[model samples]
Target: MPIDIRGSSASEIADSLRALVERGGLRPGDALPPVRTLAESLGVNRNTVSAAYRQLTIAGLVVTLGRGGTRIAGQAPVAQEGFADTVLRDVGTGNPDPSFIPDPSRALATIAGRPILYGEPVIDPDLERWAQEWMSADLEPASLRLTITSGAADAVERLLAQALTREDAVALEDPCFLASIHTVRMGGYRAVPVPVDEEGMTVDGLRAALAHGVRAIVCTPRAQNPTGASLSAQRAAALREVLGEHPYVLVIEDDHYSMLSRTDYHSLIGPEHRRWALVRSVSKFLGPDMCLAVTASDPETAQRLALRLTPGTTWVSHLLQRLAHALVTDPDARDRVDAAAEHYAARNAAFAELLTAAGIPVRAQDGLNLWVTLPVPARAVSEQLMRRGWLARTGDEFDLVPAGPSHRLRLTVHDLSDDDAGQLAADIAASVRAVA
Candidate 1:
């Protein structure tokens, strides 16, 4: 079906396209007419058509695939949780152990009042006061402003929407976070892969990405997903040096595992850097259901983020904010959260040790999961594991660049007991050997 934008402005055109997508007229992968062609047909300037296309792209309604033309953005794959099977030993689900999650009963009791209405302050005062101190301690001495979003993913989505255009290159860690990959692809932005090692994101990889004129860079500072890598101070300094040359490019540090992480916060943003946002989500520490994250950023970036999250627009729930505040500020709850962090570290470390004993070396320095490299392809090993009643996630699923050989697997078996861990490790080694 052809798009009919006879007397429409850029916004109207974009709205029409969005409606088309909703009505199933424009399906995913369906190509749109060229900007020049559409402009000529609609009797509008080419810039107007381009602007409309840009709006659709930012809204994740369409993608501008160079040479191949504009098309509807493909749907992002959902991250899988534990398998709902009684028999399968589910280790693939990237979830924190349920026992570690603090019970919010007491925190719920502490939350008072419900006079929240439109035009009120978006962030809860109590939450803001506590979050300000929390974010301030981790950040370099600078004029930082804070904004609350639904989660780290929400913060990332809003930041990119405000800062970038369709087809703009955004740097991502090679073995990227599923949410980050999904958000970038769904937004119709180009994702440039930056390699990550045990020391976190490589400097040369970032330098190369910057050289290619990436508009933004999204990095996981510690406990990087699919690899469990953390940025050492030396690595952070090196990355900061590379980023110093490109200070204008937006730098987004997703410190998602902040409290749960065993490592210190090694920042990629230097003090002099202009556009940057440090996002810390309580999802890992506080339960995922809390759905709140604090984004500490430069005044300008914070202001732009605020614009997207105005009073009635996209503000996070004040009740939830108050609850999160209660948990973080309450002495007993804070201690429980601290203990939960240590629990995850100990469990993951223990599992990694087991894998090593089984002769299948794993590097799980921090975080809830281990990233183990197999001598054989991950897919074949995953199939073998399934036969042995174990479900595991293949590293290929997390690769930013598809079409490459993948030999790694991400396992979240932190809750497994000594016997279970040993058996699983043995099974994994056997699977790899069988596949090879």
Candidate 2:
């Protein structure tokens, strides 16, 4: 059998090769037919084939060798002509796996009414009541009040608006959530650094930041993003001890992974605190498209956050509230959500085991991703992984305000099979070796 290359221009030849790739004929690293033979079969000049090969090489579709032959490139970037590219396998961000997001089509079909109008209470009645109960249970206090927001980021933004003004200093865990880092920078407020370790944000770091005049703080109590670190009871107590005198500074606990979290939640905001909040977004467990998060805060801060979430300005859609309530209350979706949580935990642990076997240490205490302590620079490791048919994200992206030097990586293995995890581990070992 012969490949039929029929008088195709360079672009046409490229498209044909791309189709071959999609159809699985030209697998990663598989050699293409010789240029001369392809040219003769297509009844075209050799330069036409040559041009096609050159463009493909530049485009990363094929790789040329001295004599072994030009082969289909492995782990090429998805061509970005116009469409938005998905950041696949990067696991750098704290996004849930596609397989884990609940199918909302069925739920959407059940909504049988007109679209909502502004100036009305934007949350479904049943959902509003249910969310209040859940928040009350999770963050029990005498002055607790609930306010629904679009999502975690929206909650953070609104909280910031109510709590601070331009140039106000806020303490943040060093290498905090990326959105938190960006939010502080974009809002023109100063971000004071509070270091985090295996236990979580350090007491010394917090005290230092507070001493420097920080008025607000964002703390991830469980499953802190990127690092997968959580505040332990001992660390939380120590933090509380240090903050005993600093009761005026507002604390926002972004427990984004609350329900899906593998660890118990701990808060630095003691029972005596006059002002604080606990925010949990349904995006992770209930599907990011759910676009809803509930914030529990003291009455004073809650009133402020509610004011920020004003009727038409930023109220979360009531329809989304209904869907969330329906799905969460449904036994089937609740069970599925629980199973998904366990699945992600098991997958991330398994991936960490493989990494350990490959001699690269990593672990995840409570989050969907593993915090890998690479033996070398993460950028070097990531670049090498790209060569081995994998693209991993570097840790630098999440550093709130990166300090001296750090060599680490945050990888999500939610959708990775055991086979892919093993291959990824092997690549990581090889990448580390190359960097060494």
TM-score for all models, in order of appearance: 0.84, 0.77
Instruction: Report the lDDT tens digits of candidate 2 across residue range 1-436.
Output: 2553444797788778878888877788888778888987887888989877766765566889869899988983432111124444554555687676677778777765677776666667788788888877766467788788888888888889888876688888877787887677656577888888988999889989989999899999878777778999899999988877988789999998887887878888887887898998988888777778888889899888888877445677677777888888877787878888899899888888888888977775777788888767888888888777666667777675556445888777778777777888888899999989
- Residue 307 CA error for candidate 2 (Å)? 2.1
Best by TM-score: 1
Residue 226 of model 2 has an lDDT of: 70
lDDT of 1 by residue, 193-216 (tens): 999999999999999999988999
Model 1 residue 305 distance off true place after TM-score fit, in angstroms: 0.4
RMSD (Å) per prediction: 4.5, 15.7
**Clashing residue pairs found in predicted model 2:** 175-400
Give the poorly placed runs of model 1, Cα more than 4 Å off: 1-76, 80-87, 311-313
Overall local distance difference test of candidate 1: 0.86
- Please, what is the whole-model Cα lDDT of each candidate in the order they appear? 0.86, 0.79
- The per-residue C-alpha lDDT of model 1 at residue 44 equals 85
